[model samples]
Structures are given as structure tokens and as C-alpha cells.
Target: MESSLKIGSAQLGPISLAESRYDVVKRLLALLYKAHSFGVKFIVFPELALTTFFPRYWMTNQVDVDRYFETKMPNEVTQPLFDAAKKLGIGFYLGFAELSEEDNRIRRFNTSILVGPDGKIIGKYRKIHLPGHSEKRDDVPFQHLEKRYFEVGNLGFGTWPVFGTRVGMAICNDRRWPETYRVMALRGARVVVLGFNTPTENINHDEPLHLRMFHHRLVMQAAAYQNGMWIVATAKAGYEDGFHLHGGSCIISPTGEIVSQSTTEDDEVIVYDCNLKLGDYILNSVFNFKKHRRIEHYGPITSQTGVDDLIDVSSKL
Candidate 1:
């Protein structure tokens, strides 16, 4: 018998920075209800689902930055979401800004959590690929100061066995890197969840606006096909605080075909009945990493090179 899992990609519109946690939770609960109705075993929410993308602005004051971070996962505001999921017996993957204290030191992380069907926290993945700069730049229209606000993720890529399938997660910028999916695939992840808040326009580039959506799907589709895993990518889309975010959330199969996708930049849910056995088929064939990979030749390409290595200094000399 082939094993299968029903997963949902809950694509949400732009969350206003002024919106309270109560309002966010209400929206999330609605999505949960929809996922439950569709018999989805797991739902993946966008990065920073509870709050607006706050890293766009450069905040000098610590107090201002703290407003965007969550002190606890199931605090007063988020408890209702937990309760509803528990009642419905539905598992979910949620992305948020986490604020925690370790050894009397406060640490902040761009994090995602995988909750079991019984509402128990199963796995936590802090985003390792922190994009943008740490300091404020005057030339740029807006700042992407994620590096300044959050610490580098200490938790390595890990997969958990749940709903009879191995699941893994990554957030925002993590999806752009091939290593992110490969790490999870190496751990036997049949399904991978991702959440993103990508801007439609590039502030530093001269590229076309329409290319963002194409690039988004391209990277995700390639990753899924290469890793032989089902990918559920949800996005936080629409305009918020003068920035327009591109939203084209999708569910991709092991064969790299988009199974389901959201059409508009609104609150939408894309569900797919993912047959986990497809992973086995792909891995055994085209994506057979063990049988096909040539690691010895690839190692030299990844090695660090000196500045002179790129220049024909010998010819000049």
C-alpha cells in the first residue's frame, strides 16, 4: 500500500503592522477551519504569519524591535490558534519571530515550528540563511535588516516523522539555497514546508517586476524535483507599508509538477493529496543521489579562492 499525506499551503495577504495579534490569530483560525474541511493533515503558513514583515525598516531602539518578536509560542494571543488546531486534530507549520532567553542572555530568531496533530510541538527550525545587511544603508529605498535583528540559527536542518511521513521545514531565504532542501532530503524528508515574504520589486536591481513570481516558482520547483520531495510553499503577499510582495503560493510534487497553486494575492488555501511513495520512485530513478552524484569533482568548485585566483596574474607577470 502506498502511503500518502494531504498538505495545505495557506497563502495569506499582507498583514498590517498595526494589526494586533488577535486579528492575526482570527485569520489563522479561518485557514485552519478550511484545512480541516479539506481533510488536510498538515498546513503550512507564511513566514512571520502572526506579524507583518518588520525587517524592512531599520529600528535603532531595542524596544521597537522587541515588538516584532514573540516572547513565547503559546502566549495569551496565540493560545487560541493552538486550541483550535488541537480541537480539530490538525497539525500545522507556523513561521514567526522567536524571542527566547538562554543562560540569562536574550536571543532572537526567524523561526518555524512543526506541531503534531495532538497540538504538541514536534520540531523547531530557525532560519539559517539570513538575507540582507545588518546596518542601515542610505542608498537603498528600504532596509532589510534581518541580520541585525535576529541571530544566526543554531538548529540544523532536521526532519520529523509525523502523519506517517517524514516532514521538514525552512523559512523565506532558506528556500533560495539548494543546501536547505538537500539537508532535509538526506534525512529522509518526504515532504518539505516553506514560508516566504518576497518583494515584487528589487530595490538594487534593474530587473523586470514580473520576473519575481517566475523566479520564485523556478527555484522551488527545481528544489523539489532534485530532492524528490513534496514542497508546500506559502507566501505573505500584497502591498504593506509601501512595499508590494509577490504572492504565488504553490504545492509541487516530486516530479516537479505544480499540483496546486493560489491564483491571487489574497487569503487562499492550496491543498494537495501528496502520495509519499512518489519520493521513493524519484529517488530510485532520476534523483538517485547515492548512485548518480559525483562529489569528488564538485568539491573543488565549492572551495574558497583567493582574489588572485580569478585574475590571470601569471600572464601579467
Candidate 2:
């Protein structure tokens, strides 16, 4: 396995409604070239990278919403990116809206793909943790309608061998959940790559604006350390059509340290040389699943999804 691999987080700026797919591909290509110059072997782009965060807008017409979803990857609009990566000998992870025909029905998903240096797709992940509500809310400044547009991902969390190391994929809200990383880590994933488009404001409750970015880093850092894996997170940030998304694109080491982070909420690339073995000490000492994990005692994690009523011991007390 390759001990050291350089990765890049390509954080994109706003992609307006007027911007064409061809335009977005051009921006992606520029970042690809920039990372190549820095000797980055792989790069990660943000969720819904091709278009504006359309889920925030309430659209009654299915036709209007379908335009944001891609029927097939590497079609005419995205082939250039594939071709460029092949020529440059770079691999990438990209998140987008996927429209697929499965189980004799058409379905949509918030999805991401891991592409090898040879331009072949290695693995795919759909966002299982679809956040926000399906119903429209006119009271808030905007809506987060992921539940309305996409079905929960059918493909479970998976890991794939990439650049001589095992890597996994996640998207947006999946980062906030511990189960997402644990599943992949159990499968021997040495690194996890993810992309997100998070609004600066929380529509669900009265939340402090600064906590948006704070929690973004908090979850990923904790997961990285606890799971003994590196994490590369990219964001579709800045104001898109006047809606603000925070950008704190970053790379975290297995030790839960921020190796590199983007300074702007715009189109920026941050690169880091990740040592796969950096987590060996952590895994062998504190987090060795084979030796230390006590699954027999952790029944509630998989057996239940939400909290159950606790047994009261008031009489004994």
C-alpha cells in the first residue's frame, strides 16, 4: 500500500442558476490543473457541484427540478472532466444529483462517485442521511428540501481501494453521523472523502450562525480521530443566487488534527500529503477493532435508531 498520498480539496464558489454545466466543468478543470501542479494525486469536489443548490428553492414542476439531476455520469457535459483526469493521471471524488432507473422505477438521489486515475469509476455512494424536511416551509428564509427531491440512498456505505489505500465516500449530512464512518472504517477504509453544501443559517431552529462552521469541523474531526482515518471534506460555499453556504473545506489527520484548510468561501484548493500509516499507532493502541472493540456490549447502536424510554429506578433510589 502507498504510505503517503497527496490529496486536494477543491472548494467551489457559487454556481448560479444561469451558469451552464460546461461553465462549471471549466472551473473544475482549472482546480484539477492547480492540484496537479502541487503533486496532488487525488482531488475532491463539493456536493451538487454542477448547479446551484436547487433544493433550497421550492419547485412544483418535476421538469424544473429534474434539470438539476444528471441522468448519466460522464455524459457530454461531464466527459471533459473525466478526460482531463485521465490525461493528468489524477483521481477524484465528485458529488452531484443522480437520476437513475432502479427496481423498475425512476429514482433520484444525492450521490457521489470515486473515479480512479484511469477514469474508471471505483465506487459510488448515495446520501443516506437526507437532512431537512419534505414539506415546504414558507416561514424560513429558504427551504432545505433534500427529502422532497431525492430518495434515501439504497447503496450502503462502502469502501474501495484507491491509490494503494482503502478509501470511502460520504456526502453532506452523512458527516454528522458516527455510523457513516464506523461502517466504512470497519471495512478497512484508511481515508474518507466527502463533499457538502451547507447553508450558513439553520432553517430548522434558532441557531447561532457561527456554529454552522464550528459544527462542520467538530463532527469530522471527532470522526477522524475516533475511527483512525483521514478525512477530506470539500464544500460548495459562498453565496449562490444570494443564499449563503459556509466554506470550511479541510483535511483532517487520523490524530484529529486539521492538516490544511481553505481560507476562502470561494473556489480554492487545499492540498495535503496524508500518511496512511499515521493512524497505525492509534489503531493498534486505542482503537483496534479486532482487539478492543466490544460489539457484544453495543447492542443498542444497531438494534434501535432513536432513543427508547429509559427504565426508571426511582423506587430503588
Candidate 3:
């Protein structure tokens, strides 16, 4: 299996704000069927995928809030999707809201998991860089309360060996940060799969809707080229609960080229036969880490805990 990976990204259309877990898995199964038809070995889905972007609606009732969180992965409602993937001999990466008991207390996280072709859960990554506010805003039409609902991720960035390539995972907002890709790249990841649910509007600032789409692709492309890894980024897009989400789910090559992308803001599958080893060529050339890296001088880049005026240490060079 030198270069036999047919990777796909599943871009989902809107799931209504009140869709059930059973219904959500049905859409996933449909995508799986489509991928099987295309001979896709692995597929990536969108973040907070099972239901509508519930965080957009602020809630006071605990039961209403907890309804969106899954107490366990592949509980009765989602088990069928895993079974279906195994039956079809396809692996997948899925994103969801996870509710688990840690230290005798229930904790919530925005999470994603990697499933092997055998339907076994391989690895899980909780989203570390949670986006959005922790409370409701009186001025905005809708809320983005990820920070209020989900705790910051606990597991750090990591990669796993499989199919002659190391794979890594990230969630929605994580892709915007360089460290997300670099951390995985440092671990020798040949391909990284991430899922996102981004609203078309920038509530924090007045920005054009087009920039939302551009910025999304820009970061992924930059990450792919800088790290010399394949990137599969999928989205839960379109109008979910009256808010339009960007749906430019795409697959980028090691060269930072858009190999495949979903044009429609709907449930679509885009596949790419990737020769992951192509990334090695870039890694060994201009981006050669061992030959070019100067880590000692980069400490200042990570020293601050919060946004502050940076020291002009680079001027000394």
C-alpha cells in the first residue's frame, strides 16, 4: 500500500437545531455509502456534527444544555454508524460534543475521534482552542457559547501510526492556530484530519462573509505547506438554525494545492487519491526541520500566557 489512500471529506448540510442523534447518524451512514461507492479508505466529518450548532442558542436549563452532549461515544444512537463503517471497511474521523465523568465530576468537551476500518476507536482529541464567548450577548442575533458549554481540551496534540502513515486529529477552531498543525507535524504526521462548524459572520468584528471562507482555506493551506502534510478539512455548513455556515470543506496536498473541494453547501463527499509520501519531498527540501530549525530563539513566541506587547528580541538578530 505505497500510495493507495482514497481519502474523502464529508461536508454536511444543515442539521436542524433539534435533530436527534438517530437522525444525525443516518446522514453519516448516507455519506459512508457514498464513500464506499467511491472506494474511499477514510472519510472526515464535521465538528459538533450530530445536531445543529446548539451553542448558538443560549439556554438556562441544565437539561436543555446537557441534551446536546453525548455521555459516551457510539452510544445506542451512534453505534449503527460505527457498525456501518466496519461493514463497509471504511475508516472515519468524527466530531461531537462529549460529556464524560472525570475525577467524579461530569466534564464537557468539543471532541473528535479517529475510527479504524474495523470500527474500533483508535484515538480521541479534545479541542484545546475553544472559540466563542462563555456568555450570552444582548446585541448579537445568536450566541457562540462554546466556551461556556465546553471545557478546554485536556489531551494535547498527538499522532498515531497506521497504514504506513501517521495520522492526527483536530477540531473546528483548532485549525486557525499554527501550533495545532505544527504539534502534529512535529510528531511526524503525514496526514491530518480536522472538522469545523464556522458561522459565516464574524460577530466579534465587522468583516465580510467572504473572508470567513478565505481565512478558513488560507490557514489550512498554509498549514499543509508549512508542515508538508495532507489535510482533510470538512464542515457542517449551510443554514443551520437560520445562520449560514461556510461549507468549503476541502483536501489539500503536501504542496498546499487544493486537491479536492466540495462546491455545494450541502451533504457532499469529495475524495482524493493522495500519495502521502509526496509530503516527504517537501520535508526533505526547503522545509527540512533538522537542517533549518532554530528552536532556541523561538522561546519568546510562546512565553506569554495572554495577548501582550511582544518584546523586540528579534531586532538583536
Candidate 4:
């Protein structure tokens, strides 16, 4: 028996600083309905889907930054999206800024959630690999202050058994790291859905514009093949309030092939009927962790964050 499911990447165009949450949710609803029309059973929306990528600007007032983070999911402003998805029998993955109260402290996180067809949140993953700086930088046109706004994700990489197979979730920068996919794959994830709001320019260093898009695809493609899991990546693209985010939203198969991609850097929906069993060949043969992995030799991956003093091997040679 073939286990298959229809999935989609619901990409959004620019959202200005003034767009209300009401209007943003409306746009999301439109895309959701569009995906539903294509017989998509599950859809992935882009990171920071609600508002403009607010981390680009520097703000001293805590209240100003807090405005962009959602105090609760499916709050009054976003309830319509939930209601409509339930009515349409569609499950979805959504990314946003989360304002949470935990252990008597207010903490914010770059977050995403997996909603089941019944419109209930089945799983959640907070973003762990936050990029950019914590301080204000006046040298660049925009700041990448994700570190200033969000705490490192407290939840571990997790996979949920749903949609006839296990599925996982990641957000933005997390997709760039290999560990994100590997951890999920080790936990039995066959398909990983992620969303990103990637700026076209690199604020940290000088790099070609083309490489930004290239690196985006390269990392995800490599992760998919190495882990033998399908990767569905959606982008919040185009110029938002004059800042550009390149969009190359795509769906990659377990073989590292880009099966479907969005052509335009705008609001677009791309769908594919995915065979969940496609990764079995790779996993059972090349990536059988239980049979092939040597955990004793892989300690540095978790033990060390940066390069240590170089050992002098010339003597041995």
C-alpha cells in the first residue's frame, strides 16, 4: 500500500509595517483556501507570517518590540484561520513570534506550530538556531536582531505521528543547521516542514546576492538527502517596507531533488502529492543509524561550539 499525502508551500508577499493582524490573517486565509482548492491536505506557511520581519529595525522600547510577538496562538486576531482550516479539513504549519510566560518570567521565541485537520495544535517547535546580532548596528540598511528579540528554543526537536506518517517542524534559521533534520529523523520523522523569512542581503558580511538564494537551497537539499526526509520550505518573500527577502520556496524529495518550486517572489501556492514511503530505500540502506552509526566518535558535535587549539600533528607525520 502506498502512503501518500498532498502538501503545499503557501508563500506570502511583502507585508508592510502598517498591515494589521486582521488583514494579515485575511491574506493567510486566502492562501489557505487556495491550497485547499488544490486538494492539499497539509500546507506550510512562511516564518513571521503575521507581521513584517520586525527584527530588522532597532528599538529601545521593549513595548515596541513586544507588539510583533503574539501572546497566544488562535487569539481573536487569528481565530478565523483556525476556524476555516477545520471547516476545510486541512492541516497547516505556521511560523510567528511568540511571547510566552514561563517559570514566572516573560520570554519570547521564534516559534512555529503544527495544526491538525481538526484545527488543534498537535505539535510545536521553537526555533533554536537564532541568527544575527543582539546589538544595534547603524552600518547596514537593516538590522538582523533575532538574538535581541528571541530566546533560544527551549523545546527539543520533535516528530509527531500524523498524516499517515511521522512529521516534524522547524523555523527559519533552524533549517540551515544539519542537527535540526538529523534529530528529527532519528525520532522517526519522514517529512519535515519549515518556514523562513530570509533577507536578500547579508548584514554581517559582503556576499553575492545569488549566493544567498543558492545557500538557501543547498543547505535544505543537502539536509533532505542526508537525513532521507522530505523537506517542505516556504518563504515570506519580496520587498517588505522596502527591505527585500528573496523567495525560492520549494519542496525537496528525499533524493535531494527539487520536485516543485515557486517561480515568482510573491504570494504563491505550490503543491505536490508526496509518497511518504519514498525515503525508505535511502534510510534502510545508506542511513540505517542503528546499524551504521558510531556514537563514540561523534562527541565534539555537542561538546564543542567552536574550534579549539590546533593539535600539532606534524610530529606524528
Candidate 1 vs candidate 2, TM-score winner: 2
lDDT tens digits by residue: candidate 4, 1-317: 24899999999999999999899999999999999999999999999999999999999999999999999998999999999999999999999999999999999999999999999999999999999999988888889999999999999999998788899999988888999999999999999999999998888788887898889999999999989999999999999989999999999999999999999988999999999989989999998888999999787788768677444559887
Per-model TM values vs. the true structure: 0.93, 0.97, 0.96, 0.97
| CA error at residue 106 for candidate 2, angstroms | 0.4
Model 1 pairs in collision = none
Clashing residue pairs for model 2: none
TM-score of 2: 0.97
lDDT tens digits by residue: candidate 2, 1-317:
89999999999999999999999999999999999999999999999999999999999999999999999998899999999999999999999999999889999999999999999898999999999999899899999999999999989999998898999999999999999999999999999999999998998787776787788999999999999999999999999989999999999999999999999988999999999999899889888889988898687787667666444549987
Q: Which pairs clash inside model 3?
A: none
Off by over 4 Å in 3: 306-309, 312-317
Candidate 2's C-alpha runs over 4 A off are: 308-317
User: Would you give me the overall lDDT of model 4?
Assistant: 0.93
Give the per-residue lDDT of model 3 (tens digit) for 1-317. 25658899998999996777788899999999999999998999999889898889889998899998999887899899999999998999999999999999999999999999999999999999998999789998789999999999999998987655889999988999999999899998889999999888888888897887888899999999999999999999999768988889999998999999999999999999999788888899989999998999778667865557577668788
Question: RMSD, model 4, all Cα superposed?
Answer: 1.6
Q: Order the candidate numbers by TM-score, best to worst.
A: 2, 4, 3, 1
State the displacement of the C-alpha of residue 309, model 3, in Å, after optimal TM-score superposition.
5.9
Each candidate's number of clashing pairs is 0, 0, 0, 0
In model 4, the worst 10-residue window by lDDT is 304-313
The better candidate by lDDT, 2 or 4, is 2
